[model samples]
Target: MKNMTLERITEVCGGVYYGSEADKKKEIAGAVIDSRQVESGYLFIAVKGEKVDGHQFIPQVFEKGALAVLSEQELSEPAGPYIRVESTLGAMKKLAAYYRRSLDIKVVGITGSVGKTSTKEMIASVLSQKYNVLKTEGNFNNEIGLPLTIFKIREQHEVAVLEMGISEFGEMHRLAEMAYPDICVITNIGLCHLENLLTRDGILKAKTESFEHLTPEGTAVLNGDDDKLCEKKMVNGKPAVFYGIGKEAKLAKTEQGEKYLAEKEVYATDVEPVGLDGTKAVIHIGAESFAVTIPIAGEHNVYNALAAVCVAGKLGLSVDEMKRGIESVKTIGGRSNLIHKGGMTIIDDCYNANPVSMKASIDVLAAAPGRKIAVLGDMGELGENEQELHAMVGEHFEGKGIDALFAAGALSENLAQAVGKCSKETEVHYFKTKDELMEELLPYVKSGDTVLVKASHFMGFPEVVGQLTK
Candidate 1:
């Protein structure tokens, strides 16, 4: 809220200030878009959303002790103060960008096809060991969410780990303009948002747009193991720092089908999976290396830890601090969170899914002690090859030695059919709706069974997780 007085805000937003001259010097305590979140000294930005226009709540927010409101329309009636702009959403972005430059903070902007949220958490955890870190909460990684996350940063916060998510092209560019991160991290390029971004190469291009907004002296931390990412040897006029599972990664392929090799600056070695307990590995940072026990499950998380280490190294965190940070990180509710209830082990990764993540969750379920039961639903935004992608997941799950597969949603029928055609040991059941799948789920599972629930956000798989846990 520093340097965010009404006069400064009006100038930053290119809006006309309509208030007494004395009130212009007053600074806002915070900024918010929701009328319900307005406080005594808060600035309410009135956004005309698809369902409800925020202009209707402008009077209500002012009644709730809001200091001022940002509106796209002129207000003639009684209000403490108001800044009238052309567009509230656009003004909010400008306000956030100005406020960000006023603060002396180091930002780590994280983006990828998948794992953006989890990786942001990891980087925030590691940076918190040496700095007061503030990170993006939940799935607040989109156009509106990114600016809101930036506004949450205060003078008390030294480092901000921001998660930037995008479905189409140029979204990252707009997001990164406000962020201007000192350290930019890309988790990996995978089969996600294929509806808008057609292929892996297109995804790589869209995700790397964050690099354009990096500070002149900024650094990029990339996943070296990804062949698409490994192709980029330099970013922002310097060598891009790479992190991965091994010392060297297979670079882009040549015309003759051969691959070049490049060494990773920050890499993990001797990665040993500890089942549901998480993973144990050795992280090598520069000439120094140390042992770490990542509390989060899945081998994919190791790359997240390495990215955290790479960012921490750039910020000058010591080895012991990085190790403790890696070990101390906890699982998010819908992303790789583990639960034990009703004599069953449930992997509650139902927040969202793609083919890569679905197969990764299957690998986790396959490691459990009891019968592996996969309860899957449809994955959205797969573009024209949606059926083929669903079938691809089915094919990957077929040979995993999974005991039974209970799949729902119309798209998942492809998965069920694929599993039915190849696997004689596995039982495949398909349902037209989640309601039907839930009806049969409880009666089918026995005690000591390990179940994996996964799907895209639109499938509402969290409800499935709740029913299973209950």
Candidate 2:
């Protein structure tokens, strides 16, 4: 929002100004796509959506004191002032990229098959200790969303921790071009968006596109434990800072086996899982060591902590500051948020699903101290073998000490069948719809049971979580 005048915006977006000469030099307070949020001196981007067209509300926005509108359609009669561009959406992105370059700030761009948002939250929490940080809110990690997020950055923000998610190739390239990150974090290349990416190797190629737009001296942080991510030798001629757990982690071994370690890499040693409460581990960054308790479950979170520690160290956060920051980290809704109600514990991980994330949530559900109930749904975008991938998750449920399984959607039936085949004693039920599952879910749930509700966002499993909590 700084140094943003109507004249500069018109030049940055490559639009012809059709407004009054007096308004050309006027500065805008902010920019938005939605007309309803328009205020005095605001710029409205007329985005065409499936349900409602933003152009139709231009008159209303201007009446409410909007300074100008970026429009694709030609207006017969002027409403205050407007800029004409070939495509409003394209102009919005171009404007965002221009604004990002105009600011003097460090950006940490995060992307992966899973845990992009969670890792972003962790890194932002850690970095907030020393800097005035600005982070992406909710699921704004795509082309349109990333630009909107960039527009939120004020001059006061010293660091921008952004999450970039892509379904196929070229998406990350466009997002990276806008962010032009100084630090790149690739959580892990896992099985996600396989319908577009094809395989894990394809995922790696798609995810690493963040390196394309990274600064010349940018640092690449990666997950070394992953077989595919470990193959990377260097990014932009700079050694990558790889963080992970287990023997494969370079820092724990104290000797770089592959020469992939950056000037600094991190690892967690003497790991101890404290049931569902969290994990206590000694995080090692280069030669320095700090013992901290990650207030989140799953071994996967230990990797998140290490990733945050990597960023915090680069930002000059001391061991004590990082420790307090990690302790302050909290879970986001529908992404491993632990809720307790009706004398039962619920793991609300139903925001989205894939083979890797489903298994990770199951690992967390396994630690519940009571009867383990897994309510899973179909994982979308798994390519042609989506059923097999769903069944693979079911296989993890069987013989893994799961007490019951409630599955919905067509693909979830495969999961139920596989779990039933594996665990004869574990109660397994398949529903054609979530409505049917909702009807019978309460009857089967007993007091002191640990219930995990998870599925792809399209599956609408959050409704089931709502029913249980109600």
Candidate 3:
């Protein structure tokens, strides 16, 4: 909200200023798209969504003391000031990009097929040890959401950690334009969004677009363990910093600790303790060694923490600060988050799911203390191998010491059938809808049971999680 005057905003957005010259120089307190959140001197963006057209609420926003409105259509009602553009969404993105340029903060951009949000949280937590950091909230990693996250930045923030998620080609390009990060981290490329990005290579290409707008001297933190990501030649002629369990990586893992070579600047093999509760790893950067402990589950999180530690070290955070920050990082909602209520442990990971993440969640459930019950839903946008992938997850459930499985959606029916083929004693049930699943699951679940709820966002599995918790 600092130095966000109407005149400055107009200059930043390159918007046509059409209103009172007196008010043009007046500063805006904030920017918002929803009319209900508009405050005095706030700039409102009239977004035309599927269900509602924000232009209809322009007059209402003005009545609520909005300083100006960005709209595609000129309003019939008299408003204080308005910036007319072809698309309010595009204008909002442009203004956010311009606003980001004004900040002196160091931006860390994260992208991948899986673990982007987790890595963003890890990096933010690590950076927060030494700086006042602002990070992307919940699933706000898309084109529209990315701009909104950028707008949340205020004067006190010394660093910004942003998650860039893309389902199609060129989406990351737009997201990167808004971030222009000083450092970029790619978690790993996997089988996701295959409906549009037909192959893993296609996904890799889409996710790597974050480097397009990165600063010239920006560092690219990569996963050396991932087969698809490790074959990179060069990024803008600068070698990427590779961190994984492999010996060839710049940051490799060894028994003593992580090793880093000066010539390669590689992190070598190290003795890192990873558990279902968290990960404790020693990262050797040059002669100094930093130990980090992250408060998230899964072995994948260890790599996420390692990537964050690498970036934090580059930013000049001390060993103690890095350790404290990594330890302080907590799981984001609906993302490998463990919640206990009604004497039942619910792994509320219903935000989204894929083949890679599904297996990971199953591992987490296996590590839990009580009986493991998996409530899974369909994974969307997996182009050609959708059924096969679902069946594969079912196979994992069969052999992974799972007590029971409840699935939803047409795709999930394949999962249930697949699991039933392998283990008749392992209970597998399929639901056509969330309501049906919720109705049937209550009697099956008991106190002290560990339940894992997982699915793609469209599957609406979170509703079932809410039902279980309630």
Give the top-scoring candidate (lDDT): 1
Per-residue C-alpha lDDT of model 3 across residues 1-470, encoded as one tens digit per residue: 77777777777666777899998878788888888899898899989999999888887898999999887886665568987788778878888888888888899999998898888888888898889999998888988889988988989999999999888999989999999999899988888999999988899888888878988888788887766666664788888877765345355453346654222233434544353576566666667766556577677877787788779878999878877877888886799888889888999998999999998888878777777899999999999999998998888766677888998898998889889997665788788887788889988999989999999999888788888888
lDDT of 1 by residue, 1-470 (tens): 89999999999989999999988999999899989989899999999999999999988888899999999988878478999999899998898778888999999999987788889889888889999999999988887988888889999999999999999999888899999999999988899899899988899999999888999999999988877788789997899999998896565664347676457999999999888788899999989999999987788999999999999999999999999898889888989898898899989999999988988888887777788899999999988999998998888866678999999999999999988887767899899999999999988887899889999999999998998888
lDDT for each residue of candidate 2 in 144-223, tens digit (9 for 90 to 100): 99999999899999999999999988999999999999999999888889999998889988898888899888999888
Q: What TM-score do all the candidates reach, one by one?
A: 0.97, 0.96, 0.91
Residue 386 of model 1, lDDT score: 91
CA lDDT, candidate 3, residue 255: 33
Kindly report which residue stretches of model 2 are placed more than 4 angstroms away from their true locations once superposed.
247-264
Clashes of each: 0, 0, 15
Candidate whose TM-score is highest: 1
Better of 2 and 3 by TM-score: 2
Model 1 spans with C-alpha error above 4 angstroms: 251-258
Whole-model lDDT values for every prediction: 0.90, 0.89, 0.82
**Candidate 1: clashing pairs of residues:** none
Q: Model 1 — TM-score against the truth?
A: 0.97
lDDT of 3 at 303: 77
Instruction: Kindly report which residue stretches of model 3 are placed more than 4 angstroms away from their true locations once superposed.
Output: 1-3, 11-14, 246-276, 290-292, 422-425
